[model samples]
Target: MGDQFPPDVIYEIFSRLPIKSLARFRCVCKSWLKYINHPYLQTIHRFKEEPTPIIFQLVPSANSNKNSKLCKISVLRVNQLGTITIEKDHVLDVPYKGWSHQTPVLGSCNGLTLVLYEKTPWHGTLLTLINPVTKQRHDLPPVKLRDTEWDCPSSLQAAGIGFDDSTNTLTTVFVLCKESFWSPAGINPPLCTMVHRLGMSSWREMPQTPALPICDEGVFAHGRLHWLSNSDGFHSANDGRKVVWFDVKMEEFGLTDAPKGGQYGQLVDLNGEVGFAYKDDGIHIELWVLKREEWVLRCRFDLDRPRHIDVVVCGCWNDDGDILLTSNGGKKRLFVYTLKTDDLKEVKLDGRCEAYIRMHRSSLFSIRGQNYK
Candidate 1:
C-alpha cells in the first residue's frame, strides 16, 4: 500500500514510471498529485526516464471543408526487431490559411515546443509555446522591435527556445532583420535581437545580435541555443558554415567550430547534447556529436534518398538509439538509420499530403508557471 511506504520511496517509484502512468496515478489522491507535480520529482523523472521520440506530421486539416492546416502528432514505438509503429496522439489545426510545407517547430525544450505565428500585413510576428500532451498553449506577446519605429520591413530570420537550469525558466531568442530601401548609402540595416522568458508578458530586445545572419531553425542543447550560419563573417576561408550558440543564462553570443563538410548542415539534439550532420558528397552523409565541448565523429553512411528530398537528421530514438531522419522538402517519409548495421530504412507515412516530420521529446506533464492567458 502507498500509505505504508515512506514518501521518499513513493516518490522514487512514481518517478520511475512512464509519464502516462504517472499522470494516471495523479488521480489516486491529493498527496500523490502534489508529489508528482513537485518540481523536484518532475526533474528527477525527466532525467531518470528517457523521453520518447514523437513525430509531428504536418498534413491536411481533418475537417475537409476548412482551408486551415493540420498537424498530426504521433508517438514512435520501436521493437527489438527494429519494426516501427506509429500511435496517433493529437491533431492541431493551425488557424492560418497560408500554411506551407515549412516546419512550424521553431524550438523545443523539455516537452515544450515553440512555434512561429508568421507576421501578416495587419500584425507582427508572434511565438507560442505548446505542450501537445497537455494540450496547453501559451501564445507569446508580439516581438518588440525598433524597426517599427523606422517603418522598415522586418522579417523573422531565426528563432530558438532553451531552458535555463539555474533560473528554472524557459527562454526564447529571436533574430530579426530590418531593411529600409531608403537607407543612406553605405549603411545596411542592423539585425535586431529579442529575448523573452516563458512567463513574461513581453519580449525585451537584446543589446547585441549575431554578427552573421543565422539560419532558420535552432537546436537547444547544453543550456544554450545554437544556430548554423552560412555567412563567412567569423570563420576563415577554410571553414564552411559557423556554429553560433547563445547562452540562455548569460544572455551572450559565442561561436563554435563546425565540422568540415558541405556548405549546408543541420543541427540536431542527441539525447541532451548537440549533434551535427552534413553531406560531404551527394551520397555520403557524415554525423558528428558534441562531447565535452568537442565534436566527435559518430558515424558515416551512404544515403540513397529520393530525388530532391532534402534529408535532415532528427535526433536518435531513445528506445533503440537508432538515428531518425526527416526531410524538410515536404516528403511524407521517415528514414531510420541504424548505426550498428549501417543501414538506412525508410518508413512511409500515411496521408496523401506532403509532411514534415520532427522528433519531439515529450512528456504528459502540464507546463505550469507559464503565462497561458
Candidate 2:
C-alpha cells in the first residue's frame, strides 16, 4: 500500500509535517531521505498550493535578558475561524544564551535569517546568516574596501542577506564607511561601500554609488538587494529618493527613482512582486507595487485610532500571500495582513516578550520553489 501512494502524494503529506518531525523521519530509510532531497520535490514544497500566514516577533526592550529568553520563535497556521495553531516553536532547542539586547534580526529569506550583532569593542560588528529551523549558521567575514584609507568602525558597519536562485548562492552585502566623522564641520568626507559575496570570500568596492548621502534600510527582493538612498536634493529640493538595487547575479548596482512624494518605508517581496511601503502624513501607510516596470500604489493600511501609533512593517510574503507587520506604541501587537481579503488580524502570542520571527521549511519536502531548486 505504501507503494500505491505515489511519491508526489507522500511528499505532499511530508511537507506538512513540522521540522522536528522531519528530522526524526529522515532516519526512516535511505529511500525516504533520497525522496525528500529530490530537487523536484523541493520545488513543489516551496511554492505552496495555498497561501499561509506566519508570525513576526518584535522585541520592544532589548536590554531585558529575561524578556529575550522568553521570546518564542514559532510558526502558527491561521484557519478560517481566525484561530492560530502552532506548528513549530524553535526556542525549545535553539539557545539564546549570550544574545545582547541591541542586536536586531534584519529579516529572513529562503529559510535563512540575517542577524546583526550589536557593536562591541572586541567584536566590531558581525552579521550571522542562520537557519533557526535547521539549526545551521554561517558567519560572513568582514567587508574590505580598496584604495581607501579607513579604519573599520564597529558602529558604521551595515550588512544584509539575499538569495540568488539563478546561481544557487546566498549573497551577503556589507557596507563600510571611511571613518567616523571626527572633523567639527562634518565636511565632505571620503566614504565607500563594499560588498562581500558569501561563497567568493572577497570584497568588491562600489565606486559609482555616491558617498554624500547614506542609506537608511535595505531588503532583498526580485533577484536583487535594494536600499533606500537620498540623491541630490532629495529632502531639500524634491521628495524624490532613489531606490538603489544591486543585481546579485550580475554583480551590478543601479538606481531607479521612486514615485513622486513617495518616501521610502520598507522594501519587501509581496506575492512574487517587488513592493515598497511609503508613509503618508505619519498616519496612514501605503504599499506600492511594481507592475510592468511602473510603481503603483496598490493598497493602503490606515491607522485610524489615536492609539494606533508607531507602526512598523516587516516580513514579506511567505509561500502564501500573507504579510506580517509588528505594530506597537502604547501596547504591543503582531498583525497578519492578507492580500486577498485586505484584512488585518492580530495574532495572540505567548508572552509580552520581544521576539524575532522567521519562516523555515519544517520538512525537506518543503524545499520546493526555493533557491535550492
Worst 10 residues of 2 by lDDT: 364-373
lDDT of 2 by residue, 1-72 (tens): 247798778878877765556656666887777666565565566644332333334333455555332223
Can you give the lDDT of residue 83 in candidate 1? 64
Q: What is the lDDT of residue 29 in candidate 2?
A: 87
TM-scores, all candidates, are 0.85, 0.71
lDDT of 1 by residue, 1-373 (tens): 4579987898788777877677667779888878887777867777455556555555556557464555555555544445664434444544333346456668888878887645543456766777765556778887755436532224667888888878678888988765431334334346778888877777888888886668667888888899887453444556677788999999999888788764567888887778888877766788898777788998998779754677778788654567887665544567789877889987644444255455676554466655532
Among the numbered candidates, top lDDT falls to 1
Candidate 1 displacement at residue 285 in angstroms: 0.8
Give the clashing pairs for model 2.
42-367, 42-368, 43-368, 43-369, 46-368, 51-320
Clashes of 1: 0
For candidate 2, the lDDT comes to: 0.56
Model 1: which residue pairs collide? Answer: none
lDDT (0 to 1) per candidate: 0.70, 0.56
